[model samples]
Target: MKSVTRSLRVLEAVAQHQPVTVGELTKLFGLPKSTVQRTLVTLAEAGWLRANRKDTTRWEIGARVLAVRPAALQGSSLFAAAREPMIRLRDQVNETIHLSVPDALHSMVVVDRVDCAHAVRTFHAIGDTSPLHATATGHAVLAHLAKSELDEFTAGTLKEYGEETITDPGELRAELRRVKDRGYAVNHNQYLQGVCAIAAPVLDGDGVPLAAVAASLPESRFASGLLPELGRMVTDTAAEITARHPR
Candidate 1:
């Protein structure tokens, strides 16, 4: 019984201070280093935690954690705030819309979506996750990250998902700059070869991104000329969601 309780506590601690090291957890919990290390290893084996790719000694929440809480956002303020705006965006653009939140710095997890009527539209399941540097939804959030956080992210490997994926850190940084300047991000077969998307960050009172709102369509239906129009619509929807979100 005590062992189970200890494991749960360790899990919660890891979540609160994610990417935390064994040494830090030991000091915080007043536990032996071996005990904390053992609990982390156990949780990692169970898929509730994973070692940070950038620093193997630090731990963070794993994909299984996001996978298990499929309905987590449904009851939240962000989901409620985004629901109407997302639907309206979908209707206006006739493209699939997604509402996603960053999972630490590793990925963006889709929490809600509004599907277009198009038979060949792009689709993302509610719990689907996409790489942070390989999608419009991700770039929207990354464009607003604090400098230190962005640096940490860039320091790690930027895995390529497709030919358009920006594996070069310098190039990705330049793209983020443009996203910030334009108040939105655009992806043309960056994450998926046949999909294209435009997205904007939903910022809080302090301008920190809480989530991203995106409009996605099949690449066949997308054209370079549509960027300005789609970008404006997505950014407007994101702003509406942000204004409606509770502080």
Candidate 2:
């Protein structure tokens, strides 16, 4: 039980600061240097983190996390159907568009992304994870969860990551209700500062949300007045993708 707790703590620390050094992780976790070193070695052996190719002393997320992509995304029709829509969304708004799916850990993981052709745009790695309560992509899918799943997901403490992140489950539930009432979710400086995003879910045949399609951009580029049309565009694109591929 103690090792299990420590393992999760170590993984959380790595998530917070990737490409980090063993010495830094030791200080961050307040664990002995030897303990941290051994934990790193164990985790590396188990394919959680690996020595950075550029800097041997630093470690980054490893195959175990990244391997989720090939299995979670590649074999599915969702991945194939999502590509053109993702590209279309990127071209339509010239903003970063991402496809994210829920993970077992109450987080949304980016399965694919279409980058905007701009000097500055939102970017996230394929396997990067975001808390369901704070991210637009997360809310889009989470909003349609069954009551039991919603209860289990919201039972944990919600961490505030950005200025406007909703921490209260009641408040989150209300916002999710709005998401369900509508067909999309919006986040303004909730996941990251100076960034705004809108997302819509791609639902399966029975109306279960399979994933979320998001358009993310810098706050300056995300003109407040244009939100309605932007939200509609994403929802429409998501609907198109779902229609193209049903279980």
Candidate 3:
């Protein structure tokens, strides 16, 4: 417990002061040099901090730390509200169902999820970020954003997680528009090959998209002309969540 507190303290310090060396952090935190070094090493291993390869003594906040924020909404009613709907979607479609909310800068953080008992299941961690342009959940949320927001989000370079990832801005814009027109989204071997997912937006009381709910299954299971039915199931589940829980 003491060590865990120290680790969090180290992270807080690093987050406050970036590009600082271990010696400097030790002095600032008033901890021993050995203790600080060990903490830095452990944090880097767990993806909380990234060590400087050139200096080997300096550390910076890692991507994972930024990706997985401490659960600020822990024990919130949002998860409880979405639980039954997500389970019903999973059971109806016999696929993995998930709800993800937007996190910092182009990251979608998983808040709640339900999985099917099929021989093949889609495994996703609670706080994992699905690529924005390649995932149905991320696409559904992004599609509802205003034009300016979408432009800013896609202005920078895009990463291609799979062959079907939309790296071009024009192509991605077209896809988002299609999602808006259809009132749902679909991704086929985009983020991960052999995986397919369909999703819809969950709106708040103000009619703004607060989160996205998705059903994911392997392409083999969905290849038999079941796309329309799967999409309807996802859309209906999202609507149910939106109606039951107003953000």
Candidate 4:
């Protein structure tokens, strides 16, 4: 039990400060250097972290952690409900399609994705995380959260990833309101430079958000003229997923 507890602490530290060195983990945990080193070795052997080749003394999360997440997500009814619809949407718009769930307070994690055929396109694998403050999917999910949850979520710090990110709490609330009214959310080069996206919520039986769906493309291809047409396709796909999976 003690060993298990220590291992969890080490994992949390690595997750909080990844690509960190053993010496840094020791200082962060106030543990003996030897203990931190041993913990890091155990984590590496167990496929939780991998030492960096450029500097063997430093480590970052390994493939197993990412691989393990998608299996559980696939078992979810939401993922099952959203998969085919995502494929159809991707085919219709020929843009990168993403499906995410609000698994944490400040971000959503991608559980499934359909890559765009474009040679140059935005891409994120399953289990990748995106910040709530600066993404279209994040805004769509946030707009549909219960009022109490929304209040708690907004009370935290909002990171500004780009010039277009909505950092002020008041302004974020206003944006959420607009998103709710419009039935979808738009992110125009807000999270990443030259990337634009539109997203809509997949709702549960009570009409609260269960997940979100998005279509992303490079700003060079956004062609503002298509926003209205494409936005509806994205929302309609989300609505279809919501209807199939009410849980």
**Which candidate has the top score in TM-score?**
4
How well is each residue in 1-247 modelled by candidate 3, as lDDT tens digits?
Answer: 9999999989877865677898899889898899999999999998989976776667888988766554544455667668888888877877888889876446777877787999888877766677777889888988888778887989989899878899999999999999988888998888888888889998887766788999888888767377678778888888888888844
> Which 10 successive residues of model 3 have the least lDDT summed?
67-76
TM-scores, one per candidate = 0.74, 0.79, 0.73, 0.88
lDDT of 4 at 8: 90
How close to the true structure is residue 16 of candidate 1, measured as C-alpha lDDT?
Answer: 68
lDDT of 2: 0.88
lDDT for position 106 in model 2: 70
User: Which regions of candidate 2 are displaced past 4 Å?
Assistant: 1-17, 20-49, 53-55, 61-72
Q: Give the runs in model 1 whose Cα sits over 4 Å from its true position.
A: 1-71
Q: Single out the weakest 10-residue window by summed lDDT for candidate 1.
A: 66-75
Q: Which pairs clash in the backbone of model 1?
A: none
Kindly provide the TM-score of model 3 when superposed on the true structure, using C-alpha atoms. 0.73
> What lDDT would each prediction earn against the true structure?
0.92, 0.88, 0.82, 0.88
TM-score, cand. 2: 0.79
Q: lDDT of model 1 at residue 121? A: 85
lDDT by residue for model 4 (1-247), tens: 9878998988867865778998898888899999988988888898998998898888888878877777877888888899999999999999999998887685888878999799999988666788987999999999988889889988988888888999999999999999999899999988999999999999988888878999999998887788789889999999999988846
Residue pairs in collision within model 2? none
Separate clash counts for every candidate: 0, 0, 0, 0
